[model samples]
Target: MVNENREVTEKIINELLHGKICTDASAFSELHRIATWTNPYVDYAYVDDYSKKTIAIIFFDKYNDNEIIKENTVKAISEFDMVVDAYDVHSLNEANFYLQDITRTRLNALPISVIVYDSNGKVSPLNTISISEHKATKRTVKEQRSYWCWWRDGSHFEVATLLELSQKYDDEQGDIYTNFVYPEFFNLMIEGKTRKWDGTPRVKKYSTSSYKSEKQNYKIPMCQLGLWDVETGHITHKGESVLCVIKRYGADSKEFFDYLAKIILIDGKHLDLIKDLEEFQKNNTELIPESSSEFFILFDDYMTQKNSIGTRKPTAQKTGAKKAYVRDEPKLWNKLGIVKLQGKSRYYKSYVGIEFDWDRINEILLADIFGGSNEKI
Candidate 1:
């Protein structure tokens, strides 16, 4: 019976790899059952030919033993040089987003071979699932929506400024932003010492409202990380704690930057990515690129595997992840005294320094922040 099942599984996988859509629900179910028996946590599995590699995407409703699943899946497909991407999605919409991202097709237009298993373990063809019943409201051609990407404008200085500014405001009042915060921040930027522009000191003027841009770039992210109150625009206890760190060790200091890294990793909810990158670096040392642009290509693959869903288009999803990695996280690393930018350009050529000490810094930061607890912050 085991021999027969193994034969059946191989046949199904072969068919999938060759672009055959398995419409027979029973055969797909059997394949799913066998995959589940191999790793009980798998919620969905599908073959992807979107890229150069023949890839298998395994979905989970909750993250279980991710390494075990990847190991077993690799062993099962040992005959082929296939790549396996595993994602843990919390909602049906989130799962649907990944499906659309992988296939570059809407949920209603997906290939039949893509099977979906909901939280209750009910399996259905990918094409049959409806992400939304109501037709999307159409806008005029002139009123089209802009492509979405992860916001990445905030820096440590701006964050510190906002936090310090918040300390002067009453925490209970939510209406302090428009009247006080915006104008005050604008003056602070303009009236401050002349900043260097292209090797010359130049007096700067506010191009747009500082509040509008900073609110999106700084306030929203700070709120998301629990440093600022979303409604009140006041600093939280967490934010205050971070402010103390900033005051003790200046914003540019390594101690403060390490704390920022910890906050961004734990409170910003990116610990999983750090852990995954650690493993990826260990295994794929030869694959790591010297240039930042080239490095982002490799990063995007892992981002896709992790099912980092934000934008509507697959291209946007890739672009957005690359932008965040380059602009936000690595920029922070560059400031942390660990990562040294190589070139004169805003986006540097390499992160050679980060390659060596990333795991060490991550280990120390995680241990310090979580107090050695394995639980997700």
Candidate 2:
């Protein structure tokens, strides 16, 4: 499905470049719509510069193949430099990231505002698209980064230097045999190497706890933590507190319960916890009812001092939390594979809900992460 989307996108790009899709306000708008369907994270806007020249504004978020879009945009910019003025490429995550700074228009908006920036530096809006009016029902790109550092040995260590030293040990061994080196000597060696890399003191001043936290928290690229109801076909949350929802609803919904169990097995790696949860369900079925509100109460009760271990936060913390979680949200859970919410019968007002399409989501989840081994041009 990713391949199919890419193929469709490439074809559209070719047509647009070759004048097959006549370059006009309407044409660009049409292209923007098509690109959004292909990948909502990629958006386009028309910018009429001070000289009355029209340029295509391409913006990319963390999601989708930003690198590919960038390469294509660069090529298109060069091709259209003389033909359609100059194309501008911008990163959504970086600062000064918008074409029109006055309105603070987000790049993700569909039919993104068509505005003019004059030589006097005055910004004027030509075509407007309201961010409030259009509500994004599906999971959209929340963040982006090129690389993430991980401990090579897979040992879960919280301290930054400890993890880095561990990472170095595993990395240095790379295909070589492991060793049991003296702790003092190894620490000295690591300190020397660290100082040499940045010409800093052997004992680094700042805390790397934040960096280590980011990597260990299971927040990986392109992960979706959103939870959807299997029967109602509604997304309970979009990349939010899904574990809480699962722990609450797992007993009642087989689909939700199964996925939650798998995640706990894969992420928590605590067979005993799963056993306890199953046991609890069997023994106290009436206490921990199947309803969503009841589920929340049961989960809270399960978190008390007596059951601290079971109540431990799932590796995937709620959105906007300080620390990260165990592993990326099961990519499969992101796709409920059904049409989204048709009504609020099962909607939780406190939490946002998105409609799900099971078949469509399955296609997306099953698609190759690298989009079918295609080489970057």
Candidate 3:
């Protein structure tokens, strides 16, 4: 037990040096860009024959000046606890830059316990603890591919999957962003235009999954992939979704999409798009449009119609001039899709996905709620 204590503390120090420790849900969503390392407490670790659970940590450069770190870190741990079988917490105030980092890792272990520190330096939040061993689900690597969206309302979320303005977003300020919103992380797309995806010569020599070299085993990148939608949420085909609180109970595809369909981007098309958005908002409305036409928003003009302001779309638009904005017949906005910012759409703004999974990280969160195995997705 004494040796175990030493080992755990050593791991905790590593995590604090590299992982993000955040408290806000929306903030974490945006922290997707700044994260340096992923901890098992939030990323995939172990979960049965299929499905990997995840936990995310947001790192702070100076925790004292930015005291929110304590709250955010605590919130992160609690959220992970609810979804994960178990996790670990440690401070790395003593870490040196030359060494390796290992912050916010979750490990599967018997006799698991939560350790919190007192302002006075006392650690170990639990006075009495219970530790238990977990048997592996014996799932093969391929069976680990499945996972669903982590709703905004869900207990904890995976931040590695979305795009944002560096931080969750500041509704009051126009385009004002937090420090974490933008980081110097190497963006592959932006880099590919100038430099190769990776700077390493060996990496350049090897083809990515899309272009596998007959010489080696490689995986294709999922950066441009779509969001996961199981029974809980719907992943848009183009993959731009404004996450909202999820209904606690699970939902079917029809019922789930119904919720998203209500919140469609109704503003932005040059001419007409509101008519379709208004109808799409209704729960009972059947909107199985022809497959040829993809869904989209017309623009703020749709909201200007006094009757359309807060209510759902008109039951049906009057064919002629009476229809302020017409839901044009058949066309999808593929050229440059729109983005939702401050409850409105910004036309022609593109989006991409960012994922954080640590098959390479050595630690695993022993979170009991999620079972002490590494969960993947």
Candidate 4:
């Protein structure tokens, strides 16, 4: 079916090129309508025998669907041998604006022929095609703050261990995990020296290839948090600063938690828990759930409502949210003393509700850490 459609399209293009108007109303009617349309953009390509290149005729109209325009532009480049783009614009100002666009400016370096199109759909072609050069605009990277690592079982110690190994070994090497990380983990496990932040002995199953793929959970979050330089496998200055704080004041200390909160919130690269917390506080002032399990139910409900409004990414599933917010983030916070866990046991199934330290939370939210200097460290 697709091949037949392509063949028909090719036939239509050939007919149009040869100035033989297609008589098939069902197939060629759209082409004639496009040529006469005052606003809709048209893109057609043909080979130039002299240059042995394919030339793309792009009819630009501001009223056309941007996505369609982009798709047609890309299609012309990909289907052709070597694309020499010719833009049809209404005025000089429109041409200038199109050339200034960061994405569109890339086509400026290609040989371009300008055609003036009036409101009446009359085409006036230029005598000379110009090959010009323009500086490409630098695109800014957008900072995203969602879809965090959902590895609920691992702690900061494991993360620290990975960072330490990355510093000694080049991450670019394929054998870094097999040669370094797994061996070190094996040594730690055998010695019975594996411990959590609070000096608690951590016993877990280990294998040389256990974390080969799982390591991405740590790597992605560490890079997002500005802790590790994944490219170089070295601790960034930000990572170094965090390590210093950990050395001076233990991981369980308030100082360490404060630093974590600052980066997690201010950097805006992980979960937007602060915003969620604020929204929860605003709506449920009288009946705030204290238990982690209870809180999870309410948070899930809140997310359901939020999702209905189409604010979140399509991939942000309820299960993912539960892992990131309910299990992972809360566990970290509880360990660092950012949010105190009450009850006989700190285990998820048995533990009492988490006690929110509003004063500290408020203070952390209002902190001006990056007010003037933008010093992440």
Ranking by TM-score: 1, 4, 2, 3
lDDT (Cα atoms) of all candidates against the true structure: 0.45, 0.30, 0.24, 0.45
**Could you give candidate 2's per-residue lDDT for residues 259-338 as a string of tens digits?**
43333222222222223334445555556544445544453355332222222244335554423221222122232222
- Between candidates 2 and 4, the TM-score winner: 4
- Model 3 C-alpha lDDT per residue in residues 1-377, reported as the tens digit of each score: 11232233334333222322212122112111111112211222212111222233232322322234434444444333212111222343322110111123332122122334423333332212221122222323331221211111110111121222212432323322112222211122223311211222122222353232211111011121222221212232333332322232122222223223222211111111322243343421343222211222322242333222222234423333223232221111211122122213322222211111222111111112213222111
lDDT of 1 at 268: 51
Worst 10 residues of 2 by lDDT: 146-155
lDDT of 3 at 39: 25
Candidate 3's C-alpha runs over 4 A off are: 1-112, 118-122, 127-136, 139-210, 213-377
Off-target runs (Cα >4 Å) in candidate 2 are: 1-3, 22-236, 248-377
Model 4 C-alpha lDDT per residue in residues 179-242, reported as the tens digit of each score? 5664676566456666566667666465546545445545556665667654544566777777
- Per-residue lDDT tens digits for candidate 1, residues 252-359, read 665665677666654453444344455566666677777666766676576555434222345646755445333355554444433433555343434431342455
Error of 1 at 21 (Å): 29
- TM-score winner, 2 or 3: 2
